[model samples]
Target: MVALAKKKEWSLLLLLAPALLYFLIYHFIPISGMVMAFQDYRIFGKSPFVGFKHFRILFASPAFLQVLRNTLIISFMKIVLFFPLPIIFALMLNEVRSSILRKFIQSTTYLPHFLSWVVIAGIWIAFLSPANGGLNQLREMFKLAPKDYMTDKGAIRWVLFASETWRSLGWDSIIYLAALASISPSLYESADLD
Candidate 1:
């Protein structure tokens, strides 16, 4: 029994070796480079430490403050507005009796999560373009003036939120779906009887 346990331990360690090596090389080693943030970096010599000079300059700038405000707003919108959506989606999907239809919906939604951000950004730009974009075309149909959503400051954050929701919805709902699936049918049967 001890011999078998020792073999299993070695097997687990062998499986983990590549991931441990990868983090050591890529993540841990690169963290040391963050010291450059405190230094006036020079290409060929030992750089003098500037401490908080860069951070002071950044915090003093109005543009930096504006960017920081935008970041906070966007993050809040993403967290608050997007949190319930996946749970709702999972509930809806759990009610879907047809396996084919559920799978089709899952595949369609999951595809966006796998897409690179650059590709997603390009797709969104094309779809939101003022000239002959899908959205502008719909607006033109309704006799409304074309709105440049990509360039609009007020609409940009909502756009980011919508895009993030679209990319993450199905992938995020998978966890909730698994949880739902784990509930025994006997629980529902007993509830129905009650």
Candidate 2:
């Protein structure tokens, strides 16, 4: 059986060559560079190993701790709060009867996902600008003072959440839409009958 398998697998090995090459070049080669994390990296001479030195510094630093805390809090909000939102959005969208409107909505929402962060930043900067910006203009109408949220630390976290949602909602919904599509329509029919 082993001999027969090896003989039959020769063509399969050839078929896998591109993927094997990609793994070696893209993944394994770059992963090998991670050894520098344990070393004091040097360009000309050999890097000297200083195990746990960087990690100790990272842990001891107040700024690093603050960054770490912010990262964890932001990650939790994005992952826990926002994760289920796309699935719900897709489900709600699936319920819509008008294909034209549905397509329009999907396209509009998905477009922001394709935009780069720099472009998004430019757009948001303009939107949130205190002087002659959209948000401030609206605020002025309501007799409220203009506020620049870009540099405000309190506003920064909410901005992250909002931008993350804006960027990912449509793209993330696609997977859930696919899952929804895979559900057999007969199951719904059966449920209706019951």
Candidate 3:
């Protein structure tokens, strides 16, 4: 048992060595570089210690503050506001009984999620064009004046949110579906018995 344990420990070390070395070299070494943030970094010789100067500069800059605020707002919109929409979409999709229609909808919707950002930007430009675009065309049919939403600051945020929802609505719903499928059959069976 002692010899077997020794063999297993050696085997585990051999298996882990490459990954351990990579982490130490890539992650730990790079992280250690952050200490330079507090020091006056130079190519040669010992870096002069200048504690909190860079941090003070970072906090005092208005541009940095605006950037920080924008980061917070965008993160909140994407992470918090957008999170529940996919679950609702999945629940709605799961209720539809027609397999062909379900598959068609899923495929068409999922296709957008897989598109590159450049392709998606092109699609959005076409969709939101003021002249003869799909959305404007629909608006004109309803006797509404064509409005360019892409360039409007008031509309751009909602445009971003809507586009994000459109792309992710199908893909993220897949998780909800897996969760739904994981539900025990006995619950339905019991309800039917009652």
Candidate 4:
């Protein structure tokens, strides 16, 4: 069998040709482009090798350091601060007995997940617009100062965090929702009886 396989059987390989071609085209082709990372990749001409130069420059750049810091801050805010929110939302959803209201809430929340990031960004911009945003209007209603969140350094990170959370909220809760659905109703009954 091993000798026959090594002899290149046309039948089995023909059956796998499409999958092999897909791997060659999509996977290996792009990965082989990693050679460009070591070269000054020119579109029309031969790329000259520049080993570790780009990496060194990237690491040394002050702008890169600040970007890294901001990324860490945003990640912490999104992951640590936002982690419990979906679970809490799912728990609240589980407690609600009204099927109509529950479905309504689910639909609204799930709809955001279907929207593109550009649309979400536009909505956030409208919300934070200085002159006539909902937030500014609310502030004015309370006789407080209207701050432009878009221009405010202190508020931009929060805006980013909020937008990310809003985008993922319903989608993330889906797993918990599935888990909640699978829980035996008798468990709740037993707890109530105790």
Whole-model Cα lDDT of every candidate shown, in order: 0.95, 0.91, 0.88, 0.92
lDDT of 3: 0.88
Writing each residue's lDDT as its tens digit, candidate 1 over 32-145 gives: 999999999999989999999998998899899789999999999988999999999999999999999999998898889999999999999999999989999999999999
Please give the RMSD to the true structure for each candidate, in Å. Answer: 3.2, 2.5, 4.0, 3.5
Off by over 4 Å in 2: 1-7, 42-49
| Clash list (residue pairs), candidate 2 | none
List model 2 lDDT by residue over 78-139, tens digit each: 99999999999999989988999989888888899999999998888888888988989999
**Which regions of candidate 1 deviate over 4 angstroms?**
1-19, 42-46
Candidate 3 lDDT, tens digit per residue, 1-194? Answer: 99999999999999999999999999999998899999999999999999999999998997897779767877789999999988887888778899899888878877888988788888888999999789999999999999999988678777887888888888998889779778898997999999
**Pairs with backbone N, CA or C atoms under 3 Å apart (clashes), candidate 4:** none
What order do candidates take by lDDT, descending? 1, 4, 2, 3
Error of 2 at 9 (Å): 3.3
**RMSD value for candidate 2:** 2.5
What is residue 31's positional error in candidate 2, in angstroms? 1.7
Off by over 4 Å in 4: 1-28
Model 3 scores worst on lDDT over the 10 consecutive residues at 66-75
* Candidate 4 per-residue lDDT over residues 1-194, each given as its tens digit: 99878667877788899999999999999998898999999999899999999999999998998899889999999989999999999999988899999999988887899999999999999998888999999999999988999878789999999998998999999889989999999999999999
